[model samples]
Target: MGLVELAFSDWIGTITLNNPKKLNALSEELIKDFCDALEELKRQSVRVVILRAPAGSKIFSAGHDMRELPLDGRDPLTYTDPLRLAVRTIEYFPAPIIAMVEGSVWGGACELVLSCDIIIAAEDVTFAITPAKIGVPYNISGVQNLIITGGTHICKEMLFAAQPFPVKRLVDAEIVNRAVPIDQLETVAQTLAEQISKNSPLVISLLKEEIRLLSTSHNLSPETFERVQSMRRSVYDSDDYQEGIKAFFEKRPPIFKGK
Candidate 1:
């Protein structure tokens, strides 16, 4: 079976992550398949695309496939990174994308869902951004994605603590549109997509582009930009960053010395 599967109903398209064995981790291959699926949906002019997993999944996605991460001193989330590509594809996709989230989302997967236009989640679902836990310094754009949803305070909390938060917290913060029973997840997403499909797709597409441009709009001095890059570079080049990946492979907690 394909790692990513596409199904359609009228003007709506659904992309299901089929690699439950890997907890649907956003590996390089899976991301490639996902991007291909989106391209196919775009060709079909799907008015709304639903990104989801199969029913009753206890862990929607484990986020970035750490095994694919480089052990050498190199940036893992570069422009050509798989997770980065997936997030950009979703954000720039003309159609309104809906994240049908069930179970728990972790690390880069949390950023992926937030990239979608609408998110319908299960009540028991959880969300967490865990770069800190693994000693990874998240990319600036991904950090901005969290701040866009709930401001700097929420962004700091999730990134610093790296703990799982119940779905209600996200709903209260307006990050998630709704948290319904597990059984209602599909129904809610379908209804929402149907409503979206009935509207003017052209207008929606324009608005989506406008929102993307506006939200990401910011003026930064060249020095400030270079400083940020240097800071991230310091971490990725440190021994702690290397230890983080090593610990994951060893199934042990990383012994970080803040190098």
Candidate 2:
């Protein structure tokens, strides 16, 4: 079926990214389905939400649908970007949204996972923040999201290096709550979700919002905001950016010219 699947049992809601053919890429349609699932779960008063992929998924998500990315002349990850919308939806969800990760998470998908209240991952899962690899100028808000979850130094490593890091190590960094063996991932995530569902939903919701507010309260002055935007604009407008996208489709290493 659907690119995203929703299920509810015992007050715990499950939202599965079901587009395995595309590695659950966050296309506009997929994000729309995901948000709708979250909304319906909210309406049904599901006490806790588990956002995941199907069991044993090899790639939890391939991140943003590169095909949907705008070419130069427009900001790619704008306010209304599907990836941004999905991250915001999870951040503002009344219930605690837990990311139950079982495979490699890349690019915008990692941002979505960080927006979740708790992250439980399989030991073999790896996360890569890859805008740099493709020469995309990542947005400031997205970068801040990564900093909040992973701290600045680690975020720098992830973004600059454009490489995947083991979920097991991220657990020690507090990015992930637990990194259990793949065999134990389902049990661990389910137990955590059920435990959260057992809590006072009202109080938990209040706390979730409060924590979300405080954690994401980074305020940038107008001048600072403009500077960040200008830098991102320059990157996206450069020849290197176009070359990167082209190379991706051609399945070859991009030959970036420092334009």
TM-score of each model, in listed order: 0.97, 0.98
Q: What is candidate 2's lDDT per residue for 150-178, written digit by digit as tens?
A: 99999999999999998877998988898
lDDT per model vs. reference: 0.91, 0.91
Error of 2 at 37 (Å): 0.3
**What is the model-wide C-alpha lDDT for candidate 1?**
0.91
Off by over 4 Å in 1: none
How big is the positional error of residue 117 in model 1, measured in Å on the Cα after superposition? 0.5
What lDDT tens digits, residue by residue, belong to model 1 across residues 1-259? 2898899878999999989999999999999999999999999999999999888888889999999887788888888999889989999999999999987999999999999999999999999899998988888778878888768887899899999988899899898999999888899999999999999999999999999999988867899878998999999999999998888879998999999
